[model samples]
Target: MKKYVRGLAIVGVLTLAVAACGSKPAENTAGGDANKDFKACMVSDSGGFDDKSFNQTSYEGFQAAVKAKGLTPVKAESKSDNDYPTNMTAMVAAKCNVIVAVGFKLEDATDKAAKANPSIKFAIVDSAPATPIENVKPLSFNTAQASFQAGYLAAGMSKSGKVGTFGGLKIPPVTIFMDGFAEGVRYYNKQKSKNVQVLGWDDAKQAGLFAGGFEDKAKGQNTAQNLITQGADIIFPVAGPSGLGGLQAAKASNGKVNAIWVDTDGCVSAAEYCSVLISSVKKGMDVAVQDAITSVVDNKFDNKQFIGTLENGGTSLAPFHEFDSKVPAELKTELDTIKADLIAGKITLESKAQPKAS
Candidate 1:
């Protein structure tokens, strides 16, 4: 059977079976509608909930799960990394039963919070603690797998024979996308005997351009423009909301350039740039978030890490939306075959950033 692929809008489906482990009922809260009083809380990274990328998608899943279980929902938005600990503390004080801290940046804070409160269950997205804690669950995604497909798509579609990708920061989660994209371009070149150049990232050197943070749109725009000036027609920005600037750069190019978004479907999250986007590399953060919440509601929460991958419907390529008709059918078929190959272990990736097996 083929693996499942999900976009940002279809997050309502609770299809995170591959990522979540089977849970055993909790000793203390096993019966009598635990969900009614169960509190699901979340603390966002610096990007806040409307980022149209990571935070937004995760928040959507969190909200969906809370609504489905009729549980109380509470959220805290961090203005910067400094706020992680404070916000986490606030969630704890709110008497939350389960707390999820979004982003790798919050790993330290989440760890501290989890350690300080043994009674509360905690989960952190995109990061794992240095030392494992019995109460903290890790929610991670192997985006490199899906990003490889996206890289190949960009290479196959690039009219200039040059495609580029940049990141918000030089972190594992961010660079995982870059590494796969660069490798995919190399793979395409080897397969087709075509020298399609990739700018912004070099997997061999493990070096590339970065926007320094996930919030600066102008910086994202400038960085993308730099790639464009180098003759790249397809730009993939792995930055969060900052990536919207890359789309703005593409839009300014008129018919000369296009882009691929990261984390969520650009067509739905950043619709203004839909005309310029070929597709998006989507992470099923929402699905995983809901699954985590559900486990709590069922009184079966565990600390095992949840790693999303192409095989599990966790990470996938978004539909080609406005470019659906424009994307050659042959290319689409090739992508499907590539996805199957990856899922079946016929193909493998070299990204060092892939989540460690649990």
Candidate 2:
């Protein structure tokens, strides 16, 4: 929660146990002979590592932990839903001491893998299993809190008085963002007596637009263009790689449209679209992934759920970047107040998709 630091190296000296086959020990410097056999692996969702989103952020953490501990690093990238089980099985066959499965779609496969292979530690990003598995830990986030701020920000900045958002799927993880974003706009309307509209999601109805999945940029672009046609000046896309299409749409609008990114800072991860980005809703998936790996290496692994919140450093809004000069000073001050109020519980979000507070 405090963010990953060199202090994690303290756990590097311990050895992780993995009795599975298909793995040969590799030499390492940090953890000595015991750690030489320790192998940390990851399984990506269909979005892959270059999605400039959660999958990429999660892998960064996994690699950081492996690098710090001098453990063997391995990964399996899924090409589609059907690949989940097969990729996870490959990690098991590779004798991975710990395997981190990225994205909520991997929940079933991760749950099955952990139960079938009780000895291997597992962590799943963005989701937790229906029933607790002793070998699996859940890495989740209360992204709604940060997205609430993004919603408010979009509302305050919209020139057309309309904002829009769409998700990659209809799952809790994705809807959670739309819920918060919609509510944020509603909050702004209440405070300013302005009729700022949210086009793609209706939090009360628990329904809105979705790209069906996270991999198709064409669908995302089409969805964003639709919102733009409806006069939405600011768009939010919660669909990993597909979300890039929203940026593409915004860019094509010239100076008329702008957007907000999710998962990672768009300015840093998708610089080509920075001109149209207002900001990003960020999750500390990298830190969570690294912490999970560190726990495994220290032999202190548990199935406890790791819930990231605004109170923790687990979720936040990225800096305004190029929009810094354009956002009004009063609006920035108002955002600060809103953030403080949210943290103090003076403001409450209405999203049913938010993860249970830890």
Candidate 3:
């Protein structure tokens, strides 16, 4: 009878252990599960993933999403615009649950891929989805606001009382930054009752703007030099890889000139010219990517546009870095005030499409 009781007790203990194991949460699994195997993929624009600007920012966001959601991620770097469709299609074929296509250059390809793969979720950065497919989400940034702060800084710091702005292309996103920079300078001049002038891309005409046609460092360098010759001591280069030219120009100018970087933190990325970089207009791609991944993991992914603005912490000015000591405390306080006013709608930074110049 004692022996029989011992056998029954051992069976009861084994049954309890099995029941507890079976009741464990899905998230606590040792190797994860089928649902956790969801794959996210990103395809870069012609600039590739290491342009150190928009492309790099978007790629970081995608990576953030992947890591947060415990998702497997695949990346396809396009060498040119022609490769967008092929790369996007390859990701779909690889069973990617979500596809992120970076840049306006990939708009057409993204549209086509999203249409062909109705079941796959799509996120297009820097461009809106044409058809508003059920699974498509468009992400855009209010870069103008951040650029405005940069303009304010440039205007205040300018020894020549003149600032210059340029971009790789005259696209909406690029021009928006230029417009904000110009307007910010104008705003500063109006507020301080100064006469600081801004050149390149007339906010009204949106024309007469210099476009190096993307990624030609030489053209960017030439443009910066011309602006400097015209008495511009501060330059804002919104161009991609081409913006490096402006940095180079600033360096060669013997510390008489300075510049503002775009997208990523130029202080770290452009160490050679860190001394000349007042600050960078940063877009919070990392946070956005992480949020998207979390949404996917929670099965709450939605098809809508995500806007990164100052209010949302999606975009802002990078640290002053080496220039911190040079920036006046009053100027910093004034900048903060301006930022709050802009967010509160007390001050408006115009974002209307600039009229074409005759």
Q: Candidate 2's residue-wise lDDT over 6-58, tens digit each? A: 00001112222221233333323442334567878877777877788878888
The Cα error of candidate 3 at residue 248, in Å, is 1.1
Q: Estimate the TM-score of every prediction.
A: 0.90, 0.90, 0.86
The sequence of per-residue lDDT tens digits that candidate 1 reaches over residues 204-253 is 88999999888899999999999999999999999887888999999999
Give, for candidate 1, the lowest lDDT window spanning 10 residues.
Answer: 1-10
TM-score of 2: 0.90
lDDT values for all models: 0.81, 0.82, 0.72
lDDT tens per residue, model 3, 285-333:
6677656656766778887778788898878989999999999999999
Count of backbone clashes for each model? Answer: 0, 0, 0
Sorting all predicted structures by TM-score, with the top scorer first, yields 2, 1, 3
Model 1, CA-based lDDT: 0.81
Q: Is candidate 1 or candidate 2 better by lDDT?
A: 2
Alpha-carbon error at 63 in model 1, in Å?
A: 0.5
Question: Highest lDDT: which candidate?
Answer: 2
Show the colliding residue pairs in model 3.
none
In terms of lDDT, the poorest run of 10 residues in model 2 is: 2-11
